[model samples]
Target: MNRLKLISALCLLGATSAQAAPSSSGPIGPNIGYGDASNANTIYDPLANPANNALNAADTEGYRVGLGINAQTRIEIQDLEGASDYYDNQIDPLLNDVANAAQLETNLETFIANYDQGNISTISGVTVPLLIKTDSMAGGLSLDYTRQVGAAGIIIKGTGNVTPAADGTNLTINRGSAALGVTYKQLDEFALGYGFKAVTSGNSALTIGVTARYLTLLSNQNNVDLKQFIDDNATGSANFSDYVDGMDTGSSDSNLTADIGINWMADNYMIGLTGMNLTEPTFKVNNMTSTQTKYDYFSSLVPSDYKMKAQYRVSAQVYSENREWTLAGSYDLAESNDLNNNDTQWWSVGASYATNSAWYIPDVRFGLRGNLIGTEKTYTNVGLTLGFLNLDVATTTTDFSGVEDKQKDAGIMASAGVEFDF
Candidate 1:
């Protein structure tokens, strides 16, 4: 079904509805709503090299508690590629498709082909479910404490983020002076998960672990059009259940899943596999759209029924005899509906050098990967460990060579944390 129409349909055919109070913000847009974000262990960033769990598994260390804090931002801007008019004049019009109505899809495609040419990385108004979040303005500070007990571990995290009131509202956009608008979505999450080494034997050559987890929700909400925003907050006057299939309406829904991992450790080498959301649990999200009709008052929840796909990944590593140098790689095993389709199955390779405190610096690392499988750009990463502090930075560029001007084309994400041994 055409997404906008289906999004329209979500409101029309609700078996039930979930209450999600809408929020209003500046008509001009805001840089991440100041209300809050997530305290993600760099592990969840999905973009860090040092935080690669696969690498962690390959080089096992004694039990320790990793208390960390990090913040980062990544922005993707189209290079324009010599075609400025196509985006500035006709892009939003193409995106503002009428519900259940025909679209300028062909025109949009032709323009993209002429410029983007299957380069889904540049950005588009008509995108798959995965890219929807990219446009949303997001900002947050994170605080997390992790404990590693032998092959078992646990994590406790608290995060506060400033996110736009609604999905698709970017901090900055090519929309030009187009009288853009903003809607804020409240994002507050708290999670506790434990990793259990279900089995490890034969001189610790093989091991498998399962992490049971839950993310608590508290009045998670978003603002849509002016009318629904008021109705959704009418004190029990609104519900979006019947019209939606997989929407997680209001505060009455499940927010839990699990991950399983297996690793093989041999002399100087290790390879492992892990799967998240193994239970196949699915949830609903309120669909945010531009044009609103009578049905828009109903659900507008996207993926009305979706079983969040389980993600599986494979990783391997080789270590130097002296244990001072190591190399590792990460690759996803499948395409997951839970994330951007283009970002699925991304792989990264990196190398780390532990100086054994010889130079007063414990470790230094480097990583390289094709961002979105080189569909968008290339990412180069660096990591440093000085004293009790660890720092990691990742930079994105269209070309690997440093010749490209950094000012005009690049996105960056960097993180730092302090560690203590148990």
Candidate 2:
């Protein structure tokens, strides 16, 4: 009965807080729509889409900008029945053997307090990307902008087994961020980019990132928060009174991480190897308390540090006189400590056809993508280009077991923009 109540509460929370937000790929190509943009559609250039491929083609003298919106809703249900029985032995010896109504209630409350914390986060924003090729430069320059607003709600109802036993715990948080980035390319083979991100909420912090494609390197840095620290230590019933002795002695840490990749391109095929987050940077939050009538409470939570070691991608394209078809696949290395991490792989096949019917539409393209994450999922997208304007839409779904227990995530994402020729 306790399990049923917990599941029901989680479902309610997930449904209420689910919202729509702008996806990462609001500009440029559809290849970056759901997966990595590097593998989307490559015509001659190894890194960019075929529409903007520059290896064997002349640099186009023009600029393009786009705007898009994306929304997602998901439901997750986990069964603790199959989890390890260590909890029964250490926390409650009689938990597993008890069958009485009162014992059942107590055990359920204890389990929920220890592990059942429901989380909901929503991110929405507007993104803009601008690309321009000048007469003097060999390649082009691109500028990116994103302004997003986010909110998160966390609920951890206290259990019947803890010292400060409480019926329910609630926290509502709001956050906002703005980011700007610029990239410069030389002869379409080498590129350099840097970005800045500013976040404001309970605390304010700044993050900076840099990317170098020729050398296959990318790095980023940012600060930490105290609320996150409290959440991390909530599971352990240790006395935090000592940790939060000084409220003015706030704790903060910085993180620095990098990625490396190698690329090889042929006439019709391309392959690449990449490693993300090679630097294992840890962010720690500390809580300190003082000894006097005066009050001070400081707390901190730190995230586990790890690196992504394996990531590879392969892509091939077949071109006709005026049309082309592309196929690609990729695999990502998984994190060990994060339960949400999964060893996921993806495959995509898409085709673009040319048209000259100026009265209706100029071009049409279609694509199909298959993903194997925690479960098997499939996505389909259709795009149209007419003169200076481009538009696209996509949908995805997942299948699992049970009716009420089954899960599905489906949404419509669209982007529209114009290109200017100098």
Candidate 3:
């Protein structure tokens, strides 16, 4: 790819786009609408907390099925669009005309120095094509994809020097010193879960549940070289599209993981605890090499082995006597990271109302959620259910001027699905 094309690709890496707070690698649930799921009692619960499958089935008479799709993205930087404009309109052009080396250095330094280094921007989506739940069991399939890009190590201003070729047609920088580190991964899961009443005392029952899933994984870890393409004397010549295709390291692997949970069900209240990724399955992603150039490209660091860390969470709920009104809350007992290694720990609380007697009146749900670790932004959630269809959306309270003077939030999510009971 030509120098300008290469630069353009790099600039789009952190473009002003959607960011998300990924709570689990499961199907979309009521939590996506109400910002909490401890006692929501939905068919898709088994995908998130195995115990929920049987626990929720207890509230129904027969079999249940749910299908859902969810997508979300997050950008925490205050002025990300501005940063892209600075790079595309100013720094990139100066790269080719090395005669203005002094000006190029100044612009590059300013771009790096002003960039947001505090938060890790993320994009994630999950689709649950089908899920089946019975009185004592639940099983389903889910596909999850996540991408995380942190701009921290990409630019080390004082550690390296930028120098242009004597003829001012080419530029050089310390190899491996300036590059964007990006990680993308996807998981396809075939999951099965079972639950049973373990103990009964007074008006409450303690139900235990366990789930195991066969996982198919694909991942890519890329380090984009900023200086390689600018070298006019470089040997390789490829268009921007071809170069991007080559960036995929093409790594795939598989493993088995499991989750366990327990729920104490009572007449008017419920409490639950869930533990996910109990086996701590680990995977590998090929560390992409720098763009092929005549110069040595061995200085780029190899990515570390990535593993799925275990996470624990707790939830509680209270309901009205008629079972029409519900209040729920959920919190993470400890912080964890998603597949892309972004920190995550969330706390959510919300309420919902449904008139089970009427199909014409839509079920209403509202809630709030915030991350305890990364970004730490809070969001307001709203959802509606009409007959067998469901729709949910959530957005952060804070907004920033994005590209073209448009306003955007730090995080947002939308989900839609259908469910039926037989």
Candidate 4:
């Protein structure tokens, strides 16, 4: 089947539907939404870089609680124009013609010759229902989800050349073991972290922190089979409810993991290093048989283990002489797979201006970020702080060369929260 063509159509539809909701934002930090975590303030810093908790305790005494959500979807197509043309002129004309063997063979060949393997798509997000931090520690509850559809697969043709009935009501070829599908994963975790002030020398200090997390895993591997899906739709058995009941879901036992970080804070400068998922916790995907089997024609594609890989990062911040303006940067030391199993390593920079003594005045923040490995798209970030409330947004530039209004690289993220101090 025309896999890239199918993905192209879905991408176009997603762009149109996203207008009603907040779309992709790089990483979920209202204070540094553009991707820099090194110079985060006390409240948000602990979650961004656990070691910041110690520095924060020494600098100020306060506590805060907030909620945030970050989600994004991206589809990259090398020749969207060509793909659209194929989809319009060839694929759509015979989308449900399983009875036509000759036409199906021709279309399959066209898909292979012109596809060229430059298509990829991923949907991923993080939701923080409650995040809190005190002078000495930090803790939170968060949920994460990812959906990845593989564009690579092989088609198995029948052994004998079969001819369809003239009446056009019978099948021409047997639906063989040809397979294609997507992977879905979700995680919910509760985390508690603390940092210790190790040494104080002159106007500089050193601190180290560690966070422990308890995680629950859920997933559906090989959730879709193109052949089965199409047949269901044609036979009028593929409604939304049926689709939901078709999945063979899986869950894993609870697991524990940890993150470690260190920071060096000076009079007007700071730098930090962090390693996340230090233990690389592993989960075995288990089948939780579905209740309804109406559309459960496909079997589980493959059973595999999901492992959280360790990721390392470093950051630095420079403050203005008067302490009103701040500039900061952060970079990932090595590549790691995101929630969607896509490789990613990011480098981010940001600048902010604030008045130390004003609660009514609004603080301004701006930033730029780019992925060093996967997606490799650059984004612009902007944020505002008024009184106890913080708001932020980030997005990538649009591409006009492809289909009109199609968000080929369309991505955006928005977060808002309020805080209080004692």
Candidate 5:
């Protein structure tokens, strides 16, 4: 019931539109990214570098632990409508009916119709340009605790991303809007893992890290074709459950995955290379039998094994004298990773200028983040660090109106965190 899995994710997750904290990636100051090692300390972060891995630019030796909360939400809709309508019509209403399969389909269909219009547009003097890219609307919440003793350290984290895959280049959405008609593929994941990180010594600039996680596959096929249900029984909307008792949407499974990383640093510069789910995780989910509820549609669990793809990233960073000015770049090699296979890969550059000052002045930091090569979105960040607390914010904007007579896509992501060291 893969479709059911999507419904579960959409209904279950409570995270809102926010920034990706990526706590384990270290304090990025005004920089925002998890896969960006060069910008966020990829040299010391295992996931960013994964091969083994750098300089403790902050002299972060001894014992250290950090605790924080992070949330990330990414959504794109046709810039034709007012931003408030997208929320009032899609996000908020769905937030209340997380279990209503029918309602979920209704809202999604509306979203798809609007989005498809943006994908195909013709310039007045040019041939029709087909943008084979999809929009992404994913949200997540995480709680993290990390501790390190000497060069060997451990980090424990729990993660959740709730929302089914909505991005598609040429989605035949109406292709399956019928009740008990088209089956929705399911995909949801939940996990907690302990990561091991360190360099050869306190002063070593080479580092690598690994993490073996207990993964749970909450995604499955979700079959709920309302039109099919109505036609099969030839009955009015009376006693809905009676007509589809056994076809209830609910099914799940679990598995395991690992991450590998490596990185190096020299002078005021750093580089990192890493792989997520390098082994390519998969699930041999139980084949749900299709129970006859409408037409040939059944809510039975269909058995199928799905591949969780792998992702690769490379990053580099440069710092000016006294670490005042910073420039960094990150490239997503897998673009479509197993964890978030639908979201587009982004080639991002983040630059920040931080000034170290006493309590009154605080450390003022500001930077620009954008997909200089991959996608069309651009983000800008501003941050302030007071003692142990850090506050950062960012906004995403895209203008594809050039093809659609001037339509725009816009979004925002923000986060805050604190750290302790001895």
Candidate 6:
């Protein structure tokens, strides 16, 4: 049993070697709406103008700054046999032995079943001026400028021990990130956006993206330590300390990446292809030898050194719209990468209805939108746009996996803001 536990721990740690970086943007639901511009908007429609970089003839004069906020929570639990193995190997062997192996198994099963029944993992944050959109129609050509700034973080609670322990305890990892983006659009259809950010203190990089009707491309530079920014801000916290220590300062490398997308509006369809980390760039961290010796050994055993290869993604959307109602469906191809095997490809379908009321308020439009991604997960968004103020709220299954044992891993995300055209 002890040997089994040790083996399990090693396996878990090995698995951690490829944990991919978290996504930098928010969820874009499946719906065709103007609010879909910023990735943060709950509308799922891929055809809708992305809030971050979209510009239209209506945005010709002055500037608009949209302050938006979103909060999301997710929880996962599984009746895992490997928990005991992990506990035995990574945690204290003597604290609690599997005196009654059968009983322990039963208990673990129950825990997994009820893990999300009562427990949840949450991520909450506020983004002010989530996007800045400006456009001008002059010289028979249109110019568009867009910018965004926001902060996000994740907090995980509850546990059946999914990852390796740092100090023989249930891993409690907290991660936070901040990002800023600027995009310029020309002739209402072509765009270029640049993004820079830091995730965990050790990971910092600059990304530049370009997009045209039916196509989008992106690229990035290599790991650049963010501690300098934190230190400059004089906001030193324990999280910052950990981030600084984890940074790989010795390696200075850059990555070349690209993505291409195509949209066919006449047929109510859209398709997109994206490639991430295409440059196969390699950036080495000095502490990797000591902090992650096992990873070093594992890497040596592989066919080649750690090279950042291109990750491919394909997505499509179909929509039908009328004066009072809209329906849409979308599919996103999942990339099979070493870092995230459990991550599966998924699709979403959604519907929405709009009505204008004259009884209570003047010029009031209310809409309800719902989306289902994959088999077991669903999200519904309710919104009201009165005059220049647009308010939206959404509820979604926090857990991406649609398994009953892990069903409790779900929650709601709500956002509200005003978009006024000047």
The CA lDDT at 140 in model 3 is 28
Clashing pairs in 3: 1-238, 18-73, 18-74, 19-73, 19-74, 20-73, 20-74
For candidate 1, give the lDDT of residue 304: 39
> Model 6 segments beyond 4 Å from truth?
1-209, 212-256, 267-324, 334-344, 354-420
Q: For this target, which candidate reaches the highest TM-score against the unseen true structure?
A: 3
**Clashes found in each candidate (C-alpha, N, C closer than 3 A):** 34, 15, 7, 2, 42, 18
For residues 317-349, write the lDDT of model 6, one tens digit per residue: 333322233344434333322211123233434
List residue ranges in candidate 1 displaced over 4 A: 1-63, 78-204, 216-254, 288-307, 337-343, 355-359, 371-377, 398-411
Models sorted by TM-score, best on top: 3, 4, 5, 1, 2, 6
* lDDT over C-alpha atoms for residue 69 of model 5: 29
Which sections of candidate 4 miss by over 4 Å?
1-26, 31-34, 57-85, 96-104, 112-167, 170-180, 237-241, 244-250, 286-303, 321-324, 399-407
TM-score of 1: 0.51
By lDDT rank, best first, the candidates go 3, 4, 5, 1, 2, 6
What local distance difference test score does each model get? 0.34, 0.32, 0.57, 0.52, 0.38, 0.28
The better-scoring model by TM-score among 2 and 6 is: 2
Please give, for residues 165-274, the per-residue lDDT of candidate 2 as tens digits: 22233221111110001110001112333322222233221222233322111111111122222223344332322222232133333344443444333334444444
RMSD of each: 16.1, 13.9, 4.7, 6.2, 15.1, 14.4
TM-score of each: 0.51, 0.46, 0.80, 0.74, 0.53, 0.40
Q: Please state the error at residue 189 of candidate 5 in Å.
A: 8.3
Candidate 4 lDDT tens digits, 338-374: 5445566778898887543567877788998777876
**Lowest summed lDDT over 10 consecutive residues: which window, candidate 6?**
179-188
Better of 1 and 6 by TM-score: 1
